[model samples]
Target chain A: MARTLRSALLLAPSAVLIGIFLIGLVRLIASSVLFDGQIDLHHYVDIMNRPDYIAMLGRTLRTAALTTFFCLLLGYPTAYYVARYQGNRNILLLLIIFPWLVSIVVRSYGWVVILGPRGLVNGFLMWTGMADRPLKLMYNDFGVVMGLVHVLLPFMIIAILSVLMQISRNLEEASMSLGGHPFYSFRTVLLPLSLPGILTGVTLVYLMSTGAIVTPLLLGGLGDTMIGTEIFQEVMHFFDYPKAAALATVLLVTAMAVVLPLQFLERWLSKRLTDGAPS
Target chain B: MIQTPHIPIASIVETQNLARDNTPAEPILSIDHVTKRFDGATAVSSVCIDIMQGEFVTLLGPSGCGKSTLLRMIAGFETPTHGRILMRGEDMSHRPAYDREIGLVFQNLALFPHMNVFDNVAFGLRARGRTDGLKAKVQDMLALVGLDGFDDRRTGQISGGQRQRVALARSLVTQPDVLLLDEPLSALDLKLRRQLQTELKRIQQETGITFVFVTHDQEEALSMSDRIAVMNAGRVEQFGSAVDTYHRPATEFVARFVGETNLLRGQVQAASGGRVTLKLDNVNATVTVPAGDSSLGLGTDVAISIRPEHMTLGTGTDQPIAATVLSHSFSGATITYALDSAAGRLLAQVPFQPGGGHPLPAKASVSVGWADTAVTLIPGKPGHSQSDMEN
Candidate 1:
């Protein structure tokens, strides 16, 4: 009994914090129905009927999916190179993770300077005569995606690199000695062994991008209104707490629906990839 | 040293000239004065050996003695700093492992953990782009190693002995010109190791494949090899058959490293007519080295080596060395007595004789003696004093 008490004491802080959040969420859900001293489903029905709100939600999911796909495509080779690098490994790792030390808001604003209409890329293009005028680069969906990918890429790389380091170098050598080429050896042996890292990186990138607010606010235009921006405007500008609460609950459920299936797929794929024979 | 040519049973039918005549056949693989240097320290220094076709040769030595380095160089994993490796008269010193046409069974067995037994055995065949009859070839190789029904089992799910067979089958299915085994049986238990050693010898004989095995275990080298290259300090000390290596060790390090022996320090008192007499250091006895051996010179210091089994509990015409029994260990068939004598500590092995009651107790005074012809005279003076199979 004493040991159980000690364990509970060790877990008290996190449990208390989660309990407070749960209670606040329950109250918010109750208030969403208890609008104007009457219990009704007014806010939830309003959110579902609004085409603009539904479009915003769809745009947010699309942008997050695109960012995660690009991050995976770019981050996997980068992580593989960094993990296999022999010389000055600490420097290479520090270079990859250095952007995380800066605040995400600061990093997003930095992207704003680079992706503006008269930014460095546009200036270079105009000077090289590749474009006659400055291209509209910032205040768009493309700008938002670039900013999100920049902010979230370190997480993906670090996850994959950690798993790559655990794989034995001898496995590759054994494959080559058995008459396999370098590419064939990597595809057959190294790729399957690194599946766990790849799954973790993809899931983390997807969730973080979907819930992003600051990057879209700073780098996107009026036409690229995401669900996070709408929720922010509903609570702070419109003072519609019930509508914001209902939207927040819907966003959380939708994110779980996407992420949970992905987690199950990860477990299933890892099993199949590592399973050697039918028996 | 004169080497007896190895004759594989299948080779007699294929190579009619070799079977019908007495002329020597060319070596299948030759390490011509190969040397490997890591940074500045020499790992293998000017080591030369010729592996005959269809022969089983072992590079035997203690750790850090450069046996593994030599084997890796032959496998095309490490390029020699000097000299060259020739496979059937073609220089393969610069070839990559995949292009060298040699198979290697690593010390860890290195079976692909993500592959099943069938896939592991088929890896080489597939890599070489041989898809036709791959399944049948894998089955035959598995049966050859006595793992016929384990096709679907993962490498991690198999036993150690089964893994050994898988590794062997994986390498042998490709039919490389030579097979290099880097102490593949060292990780197994004694009984399992013995069982696999017999299997390895049988496989080599049945397939008529040239096998170059590297091991630090002297007994494994002795029993499994047609020729043993006894190595020390990055050089081949002696290379000969097992009987010659045991009974006629060429160096003091080989005599000490290969088996349990008692080394006595002495100086040559007289040398004449292909014979020499050595005056022992502290035993107050003179030993006569037999005729037909003229290596010793007058006043030259030497080590006289006598195996523990050669020494018996008896007195000779020469004064019997007085000794007190320090301890005795009873192995199943033999009783090995550790003795403290005037010359230093020595060991003697005697058969248990089944119902021999109990051994002589510790501290009991006794006499130890051996025939002069039984002692091998090593030229180099002993460097370290105490000796028990380690130099």
Candidate 2:
């Protein structure tokens, strides 16, 4: 009984914080449904009926998915190299996470400076006679995705590196001594073993990209508005709290719709791969 | 000292028999003066040995004694710094581990934890693209290692001994030129280790694959290997049969390391035709032994090794030395008595008959004696004192 009391006392602070968040979420849901003291679903219906809202939701999903894909494509090799590095691996890991130490808004602005219309890439291309005009790099979907991938890449690398370090180096040597070529050994032994890390990175990067507001609002043009930007505009510009709450609820549901299946896949894959294996 | 040819006794007989019909067979693998230095510290220094086909050769030593380094050099996981390694007369000095057709069962067993028994055993075959009849080959290898019908179980689901067998089967399915075992049974308990030692020997003989095993336990080496290489300080001190190594250790280090011995400092008092009488220090005794080497001459100081079991107690007829018991230890089959004698501290192992009686009480007076043949004249003076080389 004393142990239980101690545990509850230790957990009380975080529990109270979560309770406050939950109360605020309940109030948001109530406002989205209740107007003039009569409960109605018109705000949700309004969101569903607008074609531009649907298109913005589609564009948000596409941008998030593309961000996740590019993060994984660039992060896997970098994480593998860092995990296998013999000398002072922490220095490399620190370099990867250094960008994350800066504010996400500041980093997003940094990307805008490098990828702007008269930025370093366009200046180099025009100076080298490769292009006659400056490239329209920012204020587009490309800029938003580039900024999001840059900001969220450390998550993917850290997730993959943690799992890669847990794998024994002897397994690869055993495979090689059994007449396995290096690439064949990596594919058959290392890749399948690292799937859990890949899944976690993909889930984290995709979810964070979907709800992103600062990067998308700063780097995106009129055609590249995402659901987070729409939610911000509904509340900040029009003073429509009910509509913003409804859009936020829809964003939550849509994010879950994509992530729930991914979470199930992660659990199933880990179970199939590591069930009954020694820790 | 005369170095004997590195031919096992059984193989010498086979060579004599084959010499009448054709030329004698060449060694399947030869480690030619191989040396390995890591960061300017020698790990294996000028080690050479010839391993015949299908012989179970064990590199036996304590930890940090270069036995595993020599085995790794043979397995192509490590390259020798000084000498060439010849496999069937071809110098495979710089071959990569994957290119060499040698299988190593690691000290940790190194089984694929993510793979089931069947997949783990079939991994080599699948990796080498030898997919035809892969299932049957895997099953046969598993059954050979006594892991039949355990195909679906993950490596973690099985017992430790079962995992060891899976590692063995995984290495053997490809039928490599040789199998190198790096203390694979060290993780098991005493009973399971003994059981697997016999099982490993049986499998090696059944498949007729040359096995180069590395271990630190002298008893394990004696019980399992056909020939043993006793290594110390990055050098091969002695390489011979188990009986030869146990009966006649080559150096003072081997005499102390291989088994329990009571070493006594002595000087050759008289030398006559193939026999030398040695005057022992602090014991007032003179023992005559055959002068086996040219190093034994008159007035030359030497050390003699007498195994604990060779010394007899309470013999009554020839009680040459008087002593008092220090302590006694009961080890089920034998009772080892530590004696404080005029010759210095000595150990005497006596057989224990179960339900017979209690051993001699502590501090009891005793007499110890041994035959002239039981004393082995170590070739050189003792390098390290007994306490310095205890382990």
Candidate 3:
């Protein structure tokens, strides 16, 4: 019918855009994975076999794990506090999410001043006589994780808070009325229901940590040389586009292999939990 | 945290004796001088009421009458600003809702959506450290509420009526001493509400728990309650058996609230022992009333109340009042005849079967009268009792 044609015409642009992007992505992936325009597994084998590649992969995963854990550790309490605020909770939420509106580079610089060896943390500790020598606080794995957590915690808190808001106060009241202490209610009811948010936060931190170039390049220790820095080196310093492209392609495949399934699992769990709610 | 007030032995002895008897007067919970205020507006003001064991008492009121606030206070969701609630003999005021052994079914029926029927029913038991016996208790409660085999089914898979039962069993499985239902049947269809009212009464009887229900529907309150506390504007106007509150209402508000009424405004012509004669537009009538309220004197106006069913079309030799039939509705059980009289419009219910349709057509002149005992004088113009008014 002409109506169907009109509707299809209305949807055509978005569909065309998606098709174009998909085709470009597919061609890029295929070209990188093939060697000299021939199908091969050399890139994947190189990714696994090279000591530098393996070390960078492990470091990337470790930093991502560390970032995720710290973000959640700090975020849970902040989200809970925000949720429990009886009035002006929206204003508080805006303040919490305000850092996200700021440039991540700027937030990273704020940490640069706060965590530098001769900066706030070192000065405070040394002045207090807690340390004889200034602690090497910046340009390390710890500093990198601290920066990533700062960048990623808002996402965790906002995600958790939105989900937390969906849970009824009545459930807590019902739990208490049935003789649960507040702590017990939090542990049993709140923590279980918040798993989806936690999963989202972990996945986000892990994916971002694996590809983090700027933060590691600026603040991390030389030992924390992740795959992202290598990608940068291959493209800009070495100008070996073939190997760089191949490495980037392998990294992309590896991340999808891990993150996609994890994301799917999180979605599946979320669906199962909310599956049978009566309207 | 636990501050129990000193009980006068007289009240205790009265309840103790009732506890021994088959009567429902045995005390389960007593709310004394409870009040709640929000900023400037008072929601509940110094309300005192005793809930007897195994009794079904309804706080029948209009919206914003503080009935729900009072129920919430009893449920431990609202802390009373001024007074104490005692469960049996111990203070329940400061205790959390769960610790008070009270089961409150919310107006929304707040069934845990993620849970199946079995898990929902078992939730309370698990919370109370009775998880060891949870399975048996859940099975027993589901069966008690007529949802035994439906336990494994999710809440979304059930009917509205079935969900309500699941909520009931969820609250009831904890073996609470008091079951507080807030407009529990309001969400159901008309037929379902009627059916559930009977089921609720049966459930209450079977469990023998004190049932305190809050409802704006007069019919629900009257049919389900042994005692109805008619409230308005955060205060109780009358608390008594349904029959007494309906027939011998103490205020004009009560008469109008519980059923359809014909209220006639008249000036008192004379006063005598237990009686008064009033003149309305030129017709005179005599009414019997209680003596203590002496506000009405000769020449002072008062409202006389007579239910429609009590008055009939007759040119009786005893008492004669004339009217014309204005409108009529013919239901199978009774024909409601609205008569336009000098006093105002009056509603009369004529039984269709017993009378075999002695239908009075519209615009027909008719004489309506009742026995001298049937009418009562109401004090003041009904001035809106907030307690008994429906939202």
User: lDDT values of the candidates?
Assistant: 0.82, 0.84, 0.77
Better of 1 and 2 by lDDT: 2
Full ranking by DockQ: 3, 2, 1
* All DockQ scores: 0.32, 0.35, 0.36
| TM-score, first chain, each model | 0.90, 0.92, 0.86
**Model 1: per-residue lDDT, tens digit, B1-391?**
0111333335533553353244346777988888999989999888888877778999999999899999888877789999999987789999887777788899988887777888888888778776666777788789889999899898999899999999999998777778999999999999999999999999887777789999999999999998988888788888888877787676788888889988888899988766778888898887777633437668888887889988877533434577889999989888899999879989999778867577989998888887766877777667632111111
- In order of the candidates, what TM-score does chain B achieve? 0.88, 0.87, 0.86
lDDT for residue A139 in candidate 1, whole number 0-100:
88
Q: Candidate 2 lDDT, tens digit per residue, A93-135?
A: 8899899789988998887778887888888999999999988
Q: How high is the lDDT of residue B370 in model 2?
A: 72
Higher-ranked by TM-score: 1 or 3: 3
Instruction: For candidate 2, give the lDDT of residue B358.
Output: 89
lDDT of 3 at A250: 69
After superposition, candidate 3 runs with Cα above 4 Å error: A1-33, A38-53, A74-93, A117-137, A183-194, A246-250, A253-279, B1-26, B265-272, B276-302, B312-324, B351-358, B364-369, B380-391
Query: For each prediction, how big is the interface RMSD?
Result: 3.2, 4.9, 5.0
DockQ, candidate 2, vs. native dimer: 0.35
lDDT score at residue B65, model 3, on the 0-100 scale: 86
